[model samples]
Target: MVFAASPLHADTSSTAGGAIEIKNLAKRYGSVRAVDDVSLVVRPGEFLALLGPSGSGKTSILMSIAGFELPDSGSISIDGRDVTYLPANQRNLGMVFQKYTLFPHLSVRDNVAFGLKMRGVAKAERLRLAEQALATVRLEGYGDRMPAQLSGGQQQRVALARAIVYRPKVLLMDEPLSALDKNLREEMQLEIKRLQSQLGITVVFVTHDQGEALTMADRVAILSQGRIQQLDEPKALYERPRTRFVAGFIGETNFMPVEVQSLLPGGALVQLPGGANPTEVRAEGLVGNIVARGDAVGALRPEQITLADPDDPAALRAVVNGVIYGGSTVLCVAQLTDGTELRARLPDPSRVNVMAGDCVGLRWPVEALRVYGADAGAEVAAS
Candidate 1:
């Protein structure tokens, strides 16, 4: 369903409270340091996503911002107001969780108006505001229905309407679409983005799914081991990751051992295990430090490598181990002489004819390879 932009109210100047600044926020749970010395800034009307795996401190930071969890050290401020020690209710922030968290017994309209009622808004005004919120969520005619009577997507929309009916300064979402099916989750991603744009609302979203974060967020903060590993736009995070962890976590990559030969202007020349000669990598492709005569790992994406004839002089020789068909794309798994398995993604499986055990050559552009230090490789393996 397509939804046209509509104002929640005639005057929404008060809903422009969107800037959030987090300074040295630290939270610990007994022996586990959930969040450690993390600082971030969310711009007004910007959608920022906190993305990380389990135990990566993404949720801890979101909860701390929502005033659900207090930090051991650091302060949180919204639009220049320090709210580090403020109560959750006093923060005036809208929150939506993975679960719908709807009142089953109450009508949808009442559920959306509950927050307004608690704030002592007059009955008529609160009901009118609730109806407007329901309309904003594309559920204008369903306000009289009960929560249990709605589908999962409908229930989630109701929860969202309730959160925004009060017109909070910042909206905090804790994997709100995690429980939905893949198609529904993707649909909601666009819906939420549209709503946030129409209302000019600042949103802080938490999720472990990389695709979801890339699809919905203007910028993403990737956390690992209670620290912000990298914060960049989706394209930058995928194309020019700052660390080995960020590269591996953001998308699929093949890591192969390489020997650093010499240092160049912006990057270094590295020799692959079974490569024909040393190849130059740009500075942006280099993840960690690379000293001369040192060991490092070269990261290459599957799509970057192309299949070539084994007789090609510059191509790396390998034997095809397997061929897996995946609808539009085909995966060719090949092993080099040094037993390093690399995968190459090819488009149109029908056009490619190669069997397992066949000899093939792997070739890629010079800038396609990313060099990471030996220590960084070990850290990625440990994670």
Candidate 2:
């Protein structure tokens, strides 16, 4: 049975499940700065992901928003109200963690209704709300089952139901799906997104997984060394990364050293090696300010590269080192005469038929190349 829509969901005001603003947030542990002057705003009812490796300060920022970690400096405001010093329980936010954290002794319904009980909700009303929450998570009939009796996925659903049972203004998830297996994790990713859309609740998710961040978030904030490297939509981040770290981290890319012959209006003309005549290509999507005669790195996605005949005039000569057969595509690893390795992703091994130790030519579209200064720093921005 589906639960009727609550009146809370009908409130479309910006203050209802509203925007989250963090301004110049800073945190430190001894001499190490966990969060370094980080600032960003999460739009109302929008799903935002904090993505970065360990020591990148993603978790510190999230903890501060949840009121678990007090910032050494900076402020956090929710819907324009200063909540930086508010207690975690008083913030009226919901949270889910990596572990399900279900009580083994309690039945699923009671587990989900526990928070309501603590808030002085009466018995019958809380139970009714708990069952409705279960139905929302597709676990209506599992309410009587003990936590230990349910599978990992079902237990996680119960945890989700519990978190949303009180209809919080904002939901914070910290790698909540990390404990589940790959298939189950993917299924829950869609489940969480569906629930969030249905309830019109804002979400702030923290994960180190790039694909998860890309697939689930409306906008992703990528952190590096306690700073936001970039905050953009998945398509923008993938197509035009502002930093070398972002380009390498977001997806598979091939980086080659090149000499910048000259700078164009929005791009650069670079000279590539390994051809009879030096192949000078006009590379667009320049990452940073580049100058003539300077050394830079050119980046191309594996799928952007094509294999050609060795004698092709416009191709760079390379020798195939190995081939990896993926389900729908094959990856060819090749090396230029200068020993720079490049990977080309081609469709269908049967169609291409290139073998290991074979001499080949690599070519890509001029617009597909993104050139970056060898030591370029990230251009930080928020949306």
Candidate 3:
């Protein structure tokens, strides 16, 4: 169902409060440091996404915040109250788990009212709250339907409505959309995002899907091997990654070897792949010693590199080796004269000229280039 934007009277104070402070939080599973010395402040009502692959400690951190996995060290506080030692139920946080945990025999309305009933809310008041929560999820008329009678998307909404019926301080989502079909997943992403804004709820979302995080988060924290590699607004993290991991994890990139010849105010001038003239580009906070005088890899985003006519003014040139067609765009893999591989993203299919085995020049705007140490390759897969 389509929902035209409408204002709701959710308590805006839920998000304007202090913050969720996690200071030096660490969790251990036998010999493993599942979550290591992680510390971050989640702003009130802000949507913060913890993004990483499996075993990256993203879930561990989420559990810690929810009072599930107690940290061996560090402290967790909401607003100003110390809930580090509190039990999960006492935390007053709403959670929509990855798996639907609705009762098989109960109707959607009863399932939503369950939380209120447990909290001792009056029966009439609980029903009214349940109906309002259903309305928020656009399931107003389906409250009487049992879980078995609802579609996957509808069931997920029921789970969501159940979590929010009591108006908790924060919403914890653990891959909540992973079970839905692609179209439904995308739809719910928008739905939840709108609901978060309307409710002014501080949402802590956990997911490994980069596209989901990019589409939904106000801020994203990239975690790897129990550590936070980077955290920032999605655009900033994508465009100006602080480490090799950040450069590679957020999207596709082509790393080509280069020699750092000079360092500029906001960037460095580096020798091109084939001893070509130095190209100036930003390296922002990259290790200076790694490129002080030797060879390094230039991190170029796939979309940043462009294929042009042989005589085009753009700098590098290469021979097209293959093309991977995606409906809206194409992935073109090319080989430079130095035997280095380059990938370019063509926005419009019609603009791409070089086909398999065709020679063409490749040019990238200097500002789009990023330089990293030779060891950047090791972290490429992580980013």
lDDT of 2 at 289: 63
Which portions of model 1 miss their true places by more than 4 Å?
1-14, 374-383
Cα shift from native, residue 318, model 3 (Å): 1.5
Each prediction's TM-score against the native?
0.94, 0.93, 0.91
The candidates, ranked best first by TM-score, are 1, 2, 3
Q: How many backbone clashes does candidate 2 have?
A: 0
User: What digit string (tens of lDDT, one per residue) describes model 2 on residues 1-383?
Assistant: 01112222211133256689999999999999899998899998999999999989999998998888999999999888899988787776888888888888999999998877766677888898899889999998998999989989999899888888877778899999988899998999999999989888899999999999999999999998889998999999999888888998899999888888876665666777565654444544776767799888888999999999998988999999999999899999999999999999998778878889999999988778888885565434332
Per-residue lDDT for 196-297 in model 1, tens only? Answer: 998888999999999999999999999988888888899998988767788789888998889999999888888987888888888877766688999888
- Flag the better candidate by TM-score, 1 or 2: 1
TM-score, structure 3 vs. true: 0.91
Comparison by TM-score, 2 against 3, better one? 2
Q: Between candidates 1 and 2, which one is better according to lDDT? A: 1
Span of 10 residues, lowest total lDDT, candidate 3? 1-10
Q: Relative to the true structure, how large is the alpha-carbon lDDT of every model? A: 0.86, 0.84, 0.81
